[model samples]
Target chain A: MKVIVNGEPRELPDGASVADAVASVTTAGSGVAAAVNDEVVRRSAWEATPLRDADRLEVLTAVQGG
Target chain B: MERSASGVEHEPQEDMDSLVIAGEEVGSRLIMGTGGAPSMQVLREALTASGTELTTVAMRRVDPSARGSVLDVLNECGIRVLPNTAGCFTAGEAVLTAKLAREALGTNWVKLEVIADEHTLLPDPIELVDAAEQLVDDGFVVLPYTNDDPVLARRLEQIGCAAVMPLGSPIGSGLGIRNPHNIELIVERAGVPVILDAGVGTASDAALAMELGCDAVLLATAVTRARHPARMAAAMRHAVEGGRLARLAGRIPKRRYAQASSPFDGIATSQ
Candidate 1:
């Protein structure tokens, strides 16, 4: 299924978890965090977290400022 | 030891109480950051423009491949460091990051950021309050980056935060005070210093923050990411000063009818 990650759509393998989806797309770097469909997935749960159809995933980093 | 803008000996102002945080008096109210600038030179120039004595920096693993050296730049500037736990979620995580920052920076001052939502990057008040209490108990001067909730502000203040930082809007959005009324409420109620942190797009936004009684402003993107970072930084510094002066000067009350600054009745009785 196609899942939106950071405003871009990427093809997700069947039964892809949040962790799997995140690793598939962006370069793993410092200060990264994620929200799945407006609900924040705690860092620990990112691995077990599963993606639903049309789930809007937003990945952010501590770029600068407050 | 106080130094004037021209590097002359200067005495600290008696009437203006230096911002007392963890028993240390910080001279400048403006707190800058060391991220998002195109280059280190630009970052240094922007910091100079802002006239900020305290600069916020994050603790990241030293990448051997990385080009910019935040330490060398910041050390040269001679500014006090304010480290942040920017991406921490839970109290435990934030506390850990704070400890690491203290160890790395050798300062007890921490900008505790417990983000609940990743999309908006808003602070989780529940987790934040919990972290603040723990950090304060652990003897770390906690400066929580939080939302513009007055009750939450009071709660955080009661929990012993050095300062309360309410967002003008989402981080890096540059929306410029989406909720000024709530910010004013936070300002009116907060016992600790209220710093309008994040989402300031322009100099006017910083000025507006000061006019609303905020003690300071913590911004990075508005300056670092601007087309002319140094110029924007200088503008923001002036805006902050002008707004502070205006607030001290006491603004005229708003009225339905125009009340002219010069007397409308008769000033030299124009023919």
Candidate 2:
């Protein structure tokens, strides 16, 4: 299945979770947030939460900005 | 008598005028924004030199190829991160970004910035107000970045915002405070802290913001973009303290006619 992570399409195995999508990017333990289709999925729920095809997953972290 | 670093004697005012926002006391009044720094190493030095306890960081998509995180530098410096919604344009977008930041940073404090356009990077008053109200309702400590409008500041305050941050000018413009009168007006009426948010080009500008009665000044470009970021940061630290001290020690009123220091009665007869 294909899932969108941070505006880029990536192919992931079936039954992939939000955690899997985030792992595909960076391995930051904390200071990372994931949202599926615009609704925030908390870190504790990332592993429990699952994603579907074409799901827009946004993984955000703090950067140097104001 | 306690003395500040500048050698000015200060009466021991209780707490030494700590900046308290939403029940949290930040030691320094110089609130920094982590932007425009040449490198992470430079940023670390500048932040430490500024002596800012609280700093702003923006939330964006995680870059897989990126190196060290800004959060790590902040963590190492022991500065509290105040997440900001920098590029959002609408109330909804700002609200979502605030929530994301809260979740990411594990803090409910947000620097609510709803920009109207990219050219000016000015806050859209309507969107900013709406987002502030929503974030306040969501139990987030909202510090809104708004135009230099007293009415808007009042409105944001009435809606339970933690502080009202009005721009000295546009963001990163290096123009300094364009309308000191409006800033003074906002300061006069504000119940919460009035942080002069942007357009601080140098130390004097930061000092003037404090002298104008602003509770604090939030700036980044002025320091981060300087040839020597750490030096400018130190200058800003002094400027804020100097300005605050000057405010405390009220300035004499301006007069049309010059007054002689020596009295005429004391003057000796001259032949």
Candidate 3:
């Protein structure tokens, strides 16, 4: 499956869920949140949330920020 | 909802003790985040409310053909960029990221953050020091994101960091000042400005940090993710200003009873 994250396209495993997609890209124990098609997907729903072929997934994390 | 000066209503401005880094004077002490907003419109509005002069943003994994929108929104708002080394764990990686950010953003200023413990989002002090030294040598105005360690802060300042940002609490914990005494130590001893960055949850947290003599506060989740992002932003702006004013005013020594600002004892007794 293909997903767009922060405007960059990446290929994910077939039938990959949002949770799976997030885990694939992020480091272990990193604090991250996601928005799919511009709607925020709470952490609880990441597993159940399905992705489309060209879904825009915005993944953000709590890094050292201002 | 309303502000006053000398017992009279007045328009509000975020604290007067602005931070001067690289000769840039920022009006608001509360630096905000650009993430977690329900919409970009709300995010922009919240930034306006917070009266923030410095805002955080990240670099994108480029596809060359695709256009990123976050940067444009930030530029449109006219807030100064404090591009962070968000994902870099090693000193070399951080330096490279800082270089990339400078080239991409057209600013020599970089927020140097080297994360060691991914779970807690705690900084790697050893790596941060190394990165700061290298970046400063490279002519980047390094603002190191670090733990609340006075000795470490002094070390960074010695290495030419523009400012030392010590965490009030863990990033995004919404926990205000887990070790304020330590933060106070950093503030009192450091020659450069100390900005209380990360884990600030509310306006009072920002205020308390200022009252503790911190030069500024940088937070994102508290306002960007709030139930009322814009209102929280506004509150933080005022809170920073109030805290700064109170700090400048200075306080009377602690006493058994409240000391009156008015000359009650002299006036009534004399009359």
Candidate 4:
């Protein structure tokens, strides 16, 4: 399945959880957040939350700003 | 102010005062933002010199190649972080950004900023109100960056914002408090703390914000972009404390004519 991760399209295996999408990016243990289709998925639910095709997933963390 | 039986005048314990927002008491009146700094080392020095107990950081996409975390810097300094929803233009965007920040930073306090356009970087009053209401309902402590408009400030407060942070001018403009009367009016009527955020160019601006009765002053570019970030930060620290003290001391009223300091009856010259 194709999903947009952080504005970049990536191909992940079907039935991929948010954790998989997040793992496709950096593998930081802490200070990471996941959002699927503009809705936040709590850290505990990442493994349980499944992502389908064309899902907009945003993985964000703190940067120097605001 | 009071006088002891021995006639020694004593002033209020202004130094020990606290700036309270949503039941959180912050000892320092200066809140620093980690933007436009040359490096993390400089920011660390500035944050230390500014004496800010609480600071702000923005949330962005995680970079695989990114090195060093601002969170680590804050943690090393022992300063609490307040994540902000910057670069979001709509209520939904701000709310989602805020939620992401809460997830990433583990703090419910957010600096809600919804810019209307890129030209002036002004807050969209309509979008800001909507976002504040939503965030407040979602159990987040909202501190909105708004215009120096008293009416809008009041509206944000009525929407249950923890604090109304009115800009002195445009962000990073260094114009200082463009309308001090408006700030005064907002400070006068606001039930929550009024934080003077953005448009601060130097130490004097921070001091003036305090003197204008603001509970605290928040800035980034002013100190970060200065020739000497740490020095300016120290100056700001002193300015905020001094300004708060002046506000508590109460200045004398202005008069049309100057009164002679020495009474005529006490004049020694009889010419």
Instruction: Name the best candidate (by lDDT).
Output: 2
- Per-residue alpha-carbon lDDT of model 3 for A1-66, expressed as tens digits? 789976779898777888887776664342345667756576778899888889988665322234
lDDT, residue B86, candidate 1: 82
**lDDT for predicted candidate 3 compared with the true structure:** 0.79
Which regions of candidate 4 are displaced past 4 Å?
A: B1-9, B12-16
- Look at candidate 4 and tell me the lDDT of residue A10: 95
Fraction of true contacts retained by every candidate, in order, equals 0.12, 0.93, 0.13, 0.86
Error of 4 at A34 (Å): 0.7
What lDDT would candidate 1 get against the real structure? 0.80
Candidate 1 to truth, TM = 0.74
Report the candidate with higher DockQ, 2 versus 3: 2
lDDT of 1 at B72: 62
Clashes by residue pair, model 3: B15-B241, B50-B233
Tens digit of per-residue lDDT, candidate 4, span B1-271: 7889999557666545899989988878999899889899999999999999999999899999998899999999999999998899999999999999999889999999999998899999999999999999999999999999999999999989999999999999999999999999999999999999999998899999999999999999999999999999999999999899889878788899998887788657766
For model 2, what is the C-alpha lDDT against the true structure? 0.95
Candidate 3 ranges with C-alpha deviation above 4 Å: A1-66, B1-17, B63-68, B256-271
lDDT of 2 by residue, B116-182 (tens): 9999999999999999999999999999999999999999999999999999999999999999999
lDDT (Cα, tens digit) per residue for candidate 1, span A10-59: 88877889888767655545344566775556657888999976787766
Give the number of the best model, judged by DockQ: 2
Per-residue alpha-carbon lDDT of candidate 3 for residues B1-271, written as tens digits (9 for 90 to 100): 3545667533344334468876788766777778677677888898877778888876544333332355656778888777888877899768867765665466788888999978888899999999999999989999899999889999999999999999988888999999999998998888888999988998899999999999888888998788999999899999988888788768767899876678665554443
User: Candidate 1: where are CA atoms >4 Å away?
Assistant: A1-66, B1-17, B261-271
Worst 10 residues of 4 chain A by lDDT: A23-32
